[model samples]
Target chain A: MSFKTTVITILIYFYAACGATAQEPTNYSAKNGLPTNHVYDVQEDKDGVMWFATNRGLVKFDGKNFKAFTIKEGLPNNDVWELYLDGKKRLWVFSKSRYQSYVLNDSIYNFATSDGKTISPAPIYEVDNALWLRAGYYKFDGAEFKVQNDYATFYHGGSQQVFQKHGLNAEAAAVSYDFIFNQYFLIKDGELWFLNADGTVLKK
Target chain B: MSRRDSQSAYRFGNLFILINDKGIIVINTIAHTLKHIAFKDLNIFIQPFDTNQKCVFVNNTYQISVPNYLLIFNAGFELIEKHPFPEALEIHHAFKDSRGHIWACSFKKGIFLYTAAQLRTLYYLKGKK
Candidate 1:
């Protein structure tokens, strides 16, 4: 082979040798104009906009443009934990304050917001519009977070699954893209826990 | 998976919050299989027998930033290949699929399907001629 051909061949071979590795991250922080660098959770809104639950506040990012919200914005709480998009495309945010708040789709309300009472057995996800929260020992007002007789019925509204704290203040759990068959998971006791439809935790 | 290899890998961090901080390492499964456990690494439950198998996997990429370098490893854990990916990508996952496809996911950059000589080279790694 000619020297030029050999050199090009070697270059191609060298290039191919280096392309194998791991994957990359798609989301960006304030570097991408988000409100904060510490983003706890991110979910796609109905309109395809991405909402970030940040340490600073709530942020909405379209392909272009970013909007931020915080306690100053009349939100009952500012420290957000779980970020959920409901069946109606409305947004629900759970915070460390224990209150659950709701925002309508399309941000139509500039003057109204739904700030529910401090919820114990804090929220996890929204399955079909109902809030699927953890049914652990949580209390509201003076009621310590505890489970009651009606606790069984709560899972029907989606609390049937059990998930453990992944780590320090982690609010996300494993969600099977296939929602049915009850295959979602969370790490508990060093084992993968699957929330059974019958309110039982199964080892994965 | 075996102690034979240097397990000398660093943790990978993701810039996207959509993903949680995970424990992911890009390893040549074939090399792990070859160095120690015989038929086990193939995800095989049964069947055994082998010498120093070259194993599967074309290469592993070690990126400090984006699409970086393709790393090749021999039976002795020596790097025998080094390919560069200049596409400026962000990958998410890497492993062999059920269909013998060597898959890799980019961090929203896009997924790559190995075709042509790259796939050919990977076959050569897994004992395929």
Candidate 2:
């Protein structure tokens, strides 16, 4: 073999040797410890335990094993949507079927409106200090969730008018708060509305 | 070493990987060479995320998730494997955990766990207790 040809052949083998080794992944499914293979959300708690929210149940994993929880275990609903950890280290579980909160020492608490309306886990978000959950924005006052009606009014920069949330022609697509400017922004029919700290209308 | 098209960029050792809507561009800082890895046949927009740079997988790193596929490449910017997920309509986000495992969210189906060379499908199912 020619000297240059041998050099190229050795280089090919060297490159192949440096490639990744063929190692397959280890899967855990219903056949194993997990209650079901389908997992909507997976989160790790402060204690390092992994929590899996599934369609039929909620599963907890401690690195090796899986423990399932559902309505039978005091959870409000079976079909879980997402899991949120609030500032107080409390884990809040949202579900399209039901909503619940879990504390380490305390038991799971069901969430509902003051008027006896069960909060559905659809448009839930942890914005600023309080949670934008259910049909209203609420915060945990160390005992229960209290809905805040302080943000009842908002401004519209396009029409140059202010409208209440219950106004006849008022339509709100999405609502969010901006921490930087300490204001609330709402998207209504593709128009941006900014609200001051006191829920008063602000110009765009 | 510089690419403006990518929304995210990652550096591994002497190589810099830039990803955008088109494909991944791998640049070797020491060699002063740029190599483009195209996935045009797949018809998917490629994006890059921060991962363990020393995982010893593709490119002395790990895997990256495309919209419907997980592409694993080597340090030489060569294609290692293309793991497809037809059920995953769209991937909302993809990131690597502290355990060197890549997690991708499908938004509708469920989250996917990609570790080693195996793709484990975690379906969103529920059980009572």
- TM-score for candidate 2: 0.51
Interface RMSD (Å), every candidate: 14.6, 12.9
Worst 10 residues of 1 chain B by lDDT: B11-20
* TM-score against truth, every candidate: 0.38, 0.51
Residue B38 of model 1 has an lDDT of: 19
Give the alpha carbon lDDT tens digit for every residue of A46-121 in model 1: 6656565656767766556777778776455565544655556566665655444656543422221123334421
- Minimum summed lDDT over a 10-residue window in model 1 chain A is located at A108-117
Name the runs in model 2 displaced over 4 angstroms: A1-26, A97-99, A103-112, A122-134, A150-203, B1-100, B105-111, B115-129
- Which number leads on DockQ? 2
Model 1 CAPRI rating? incorrect
Model 1 C-alpha lDDT per residue in residues B1-129, reported as the tens digit of each score: 111111112111211001111221232221211112212232223212121011222223221111232334443444444333434543323333333333333334323334334555554554532
